[model samples]
Target: KEVKKEIRNKVDAKDVNVLLDTKADVDEVNRALVDLNGQLNLKASMMDITATLQEQALLNTTLVAELCLGRWIWKSLRTKQGGLVPWNLQTANSDPSNLVWERDRTHIVCATPGLYELSIGFFSRRRPLVKVLVNSEPVLTVNTPPQGVTHHAGGRVSQSGRYTNSSVTGLTHHDFLALPAKAKVSLLYEGDDD
Candidate 1:
């Protein structure tokens, strides 16, 4: 009876309640720790993505511009003076970070000085000579040959047949040219017919 009384004194109702409350507190603390770890991992992933974007922005420093002729351009008359081709459409302009294009004029102005790839394409029903010019100086020229042939029969023994050419011709030129800041570039066309 004495031993039993000592055990009862040591583990009373209040002590048992206190032990249960302590276990509950430990479980709540564990859940909070788990949530905090998940949030830290998400923050780390976000930081990595931001760093990658910054690196890509630094590596991609090129500026590009593209101009195109309007529809029904083939119906226009051609000139032999090699005049500047009027581009009525702008397919792409610079990224605004490094270049600017004049929408009203036939010039593409560079904001950053670097080597740029210039490409020009000309399509015409007659054989045409296309020139890519930088600051009024011709850098590249493309001459498209006539496409079709027409045969004419002749009675003369020396001249049996005569061939005439007719068809649409296309010419393209690609050049890697270096330009300083504020340089102007344009395309010139010379042909007999549109």
Candidate 2:
């Protein structure tokens, strides 16, 4: 009985009501804080996912091309010479994207700017020096050694085959070049003796 009397004296009805109100306010504020934290976490996760997806989309934008000078022969040439050689540019066979062959099919025009890996090959009677040119400037060269035999069976005959060896030599070159948008690429041939 005495303890109950002391407790009632220390905490009156009004004091108990005020304490309860303060506790309710604290509980409500805690709940709101928790809700706000959850929302912030969700937003951060969504932003991370969006950034990852954007990076993947950028990576998917790829451009590739393959070209060859198929069976095109240039005869009766002397001295160190280099020029843009025509390529057998069948769009179906070449499978080019973000790039286009010019009207003459001697050069490739880039539609997008990025790093491109170019692989070029040439086959001719003599092992001609192959060069990859960007905007009419030679950036890479490959001097392939003669592959096949040079045959002279009969006397010097006035013919293309007689002057230029008939044996075909293959030359291939690969280069990773950084090109800007609308850049032009071409294959230049040199070292052909008639």
Candidate 3:
């Protein structure tokens, strides 16, 4: 009779409540699993974005480095050895195959055919008839800012010859020319002081 009483309680409210509690626990676990999956997905998206940003940054840096090619700078030139400049600036001679330094003492031979920007700086109070020559031919002659002022498109001049606080007598001539392949470019700073 005692065993029968214990078996009847199994179908009563006390044991029935235990089954309901198990169902609630399972429901909570399902909700937690969904939240954890969402977190994983968010982490994956952030990683992808970070990877794409790194790739883009690398591409931009390479582009800037290429654009900096074919640039040259020479400073403190007291005398002209045939007016031929060996650009100490590394960017000018970045491509050794294209920019030939030892081929000719006065010229840089360009092996590629494309539009090139050439800049030549000199100190002359009179703007002494400076020009660009490609393959021994004149292409463009530069102009200066009025009588005693720095030009708008001129570079910063460090040597003495500052006529005024805002004016510099130095000239930075800039010209863009389409040069043919294997064409030699040189300068002519040959003029007497009058």
lDDT (CA) for every model shown? 0.58, 0.61, 0.63
Residue 83 error for model 2, in Å? 2.1
Task: Please list all clashing residue pairs in model 1, or write none if there are none.
Answer: none
lDDT score at residue 192, model 2, on the 0-100 scale: 43
Top model number, lDDT: 3
Candidate 2 stretches with Cα past 4 Å from truth are: 1-82, 91-97, 145-169, 191-194
- What would the TM-scores of all predictions be? 0.55, 0.45, 0.48
Clashes of each: 0, 0, 0
Model 1 lDDT per residue over 111-183, tens place: 6566777655564454467777778788777774334633222212333345133333355556687887777
Model 2 residue 88 CA deviation (Å) reads 4.2
**lDDT per residue as tens, model 2, 1-194:** 99988987796788878888777577788999999998987665777889999888766543223332212223223222346676553433233455665344556777667777776665544567777778888887788543563433332334566445443335665668899897888777774443
Best by TM-score: 1
- Candidate achieving higher TM-score, 1 or 3: 1
Tens-digit lDDT track of model 3 for 114-185: 877777666543455565678988777665544666444343355545533222445666668788999987
RMSD to the true structure for each prediction, in A, is 11.2, 14.4, 8.9
What is the lDDT for 35 in model 2?
99
Stronger candidate by TM-score (2 vs 3):
3
